[model samples]
Target chain A: MLFYDCSTAPNPRRARMFIAEKGVEVESRDISIAKGEQLQPAFRAVNSRATIPVLVTDEGTVLTENLGIAAYLEARFPEPPLMGRSADEKGLVLMWNAIAEQQGGAPVADALRNGHPAFKDRAIPGPANHAQIPELAQRGVARVAQFFDLLEERLNESPFIACDHFTLADISTFVFVDFARVIKMRVPEGNTATRAWYEAIKARPSAQI
Target chain B: MLFYDCSTAPNPRRARMFIAEKGVEVESRDISIAKGEQLQPAFRAVNSRATIPVLVTDEGTVLTENLGIAAYLEARFPEPPLMGRSADEKGLVLMWNAIAEQQGGAPVADALRNGHPAFKDRAIPGPANHAQIPELAQRGVARVAQFFDLLEERLNESPFIACDHFTLADISTFVFVDFARVIKMRVPEGNTATRAWYEAIKARPSAQI
Candidate 1:
């Protein structure tokens, strides 16, 4: 398998941390997002979406989304499962992961893309360029603040976002929370549960990458 | 299982169709989104997110996300699986499904929420209200158009979005494309592959509900 990675991006980092945790090796290709390499013809041939963290499988199938890559890797490398082991665990893993993506990841992107002048006309992802809306930045920031509280509430109830085991839910959430630094958001000082959870995930060796 | 449904919303419709396809009958409670029922304190207690299509599992776990409900149902009733039977198929199913949700579903939502007056201050889904950005609606329409091209390209390659099977990928794409009508967008006349795929999914009995 060949993994298309972007060291600076949150989505690719999620895949990277997952791959590190599983101890699986894949030929890596770096696509610098800041250099506009993802939109280049070479990368476009691999994924028309023009997104990073693509996994080209041994069978020649290209998995463009993180969920696909994770599922395939988990299936192939099951010793240290990052998704989940049981039916209930799988459901919770997917659920929390989606929540982290939508509530946390999306808001961070919104706050950055819609607010930053650097992302002017490039608010939305993909091949098309979209003009930013300043108003969206405020909304994004507000949503992210709420997301931090939600993370705290969830963490207070369970050890990990999904439950006892550290699964894909934690990986995605950890990456998103860490990437939130770009939007100037962090685990609030009062959010002890979320702060502790973030620290725990950060201490993991897989997070070093 | 008790399924909280909304006949008008796309997200809930995905779960409803999945349930219909599986032939697993759950006691359905219609939460009319048009009536702001999702925001009621009663529904808020079920899901803090205040979203519809929540499944109260037999074990009393509240499955809030569509993936969660699908995973739970797929495990309990494996026949005519909406995800996939094999590992490779599951990976492809999830991969395509995530693309459908992010690329297709999110765009339709952006178009509607950002443009429609009824959705004013509700641009983003969740417990909080977000003001609409008219500019985002235009960007959304453009993104949806690109999503259509992507769909056309994918459908031309395989019988279904993920491949030969009609799985969660097809369900999500179908619901999002159909919901795009509210934003005054539909499959372009030139996209024959996408048009045919739409017709095929619509013909399914599950789509009727």
Candidate 2:
């Protein structure tokens, strides 16, 4: 298997952390998002969507999205089961993962893409270019603030984002929370549970990648 | 098990179709999104996120997101498997499903929510009020057009969105393509492959719901 990664991107980092946790080795290559390498024709041939964190399976099937790559990895390497162990646990994992992506990741991307000068014409990712909207940048920041609150509440209930143990949900949430710094936000000083949870995940070997 | 539904919304419809396809019976109550019932305190008690198609499992666990609900049902039922039968197939299913969502559902929602007066101050979902951006509306329409082309290309390669047979990816893609009509878009006349695939999924009994 071959994995395409971007050292600076959050989505790829989630997959990277997952791979680290599974202790699986896949030939990996880095695509420089800062250099706009993903939009070039060579990478485009591999994934027409022009997104990073793609995994080409042994059979040559290209898995483009993070969810797809994670699903494949978890199924193929079931030992450390990052997704979940049971029916309800699986549901919770997916639920929290989606929440982290939608409520946390999406907003952080919006705040950065629409607010950053470097992303002036790249507010949305993919093959196409989208002009930034200042209003969206403002909304993104506000939503991210709310997302931190949501994480704090969830963490207060359980040690991890999804359940009692570390799972893919934690990986997703951890990445987004760390990435939130780009938007000049953090787990509030008062959100002790979320702050503690973030620190714990950061100490993991998988997180260092 | 109790299911909360909104007959008019596309997201809930995706879960509803999945349930119908699986031939699973769960007592369901309609939450009138049109009436802003999703935001009321009563429903808020069930799901603070103010989203619909929530499933309260037999164990009293609340599954809020569509993916979560689908994961729970797929695990419990495990027949006529919509997620896919193998590791590779599961990855492909999630990949295609996400493509349909980011490429199809999101843009459709963006166009309508930003352009339609009915969605004023409710551009983004979940217990929040966000002013719409006209630029996003324009970008969304353009993206939705590109999504049609993406679907056309994929349908030409495979009979179904993800694999040889119908699966969760088809459910997600079908709902989004149908919902695109709200933005005054349809499968283009020349895309025979996509038109045929859409027609086939539309003919399914689950779609009739």
lDDT of 2: 0.91
**Candidate 1 similarity to native, TM-score:** 0.97
lDDT of each: 0.88, 0.91
Instruction: Report DockQ per prediction, comma-separated.
Output: 0.72, 0.82
Model 2 residue B29 lDDT score? 97
The Cα error of candidate 1 at residue A147, in Å, is 0.5
Worst 10 residues of 1 chain B by lDDT: B81-90
**Runs in model 2 with CA error above 4 Å?**
none
Q: Write model 1 residue lDDT over B141-163, tens digit each, in one string.
A: 88888899889988899999897
Clashing pairs in 1: none
The sequence of per-residue lDDT tens digits that candidate 2 reaches over residues A1-209 is 99999999999999899889999999999999999999999999999899988999998889988889988888889989888788898999999888988899988998999999999889888888888988889989999999988988888789988878999999999999999999899889999999888899999999998
lDDT of 1 by residue, A118-189 (tens): 888888778888888888788889888999989999999999998698999999999999999998888899
- Highest-scoring model, DockQ: 2
Candidate 2, B102-166: lDDT as tens digits: 88998999999999999999999989899988888988999999999999999889999998999
Consecutive 10-residue window with the lowest summed lDDT within model 2 chain A: A79-88
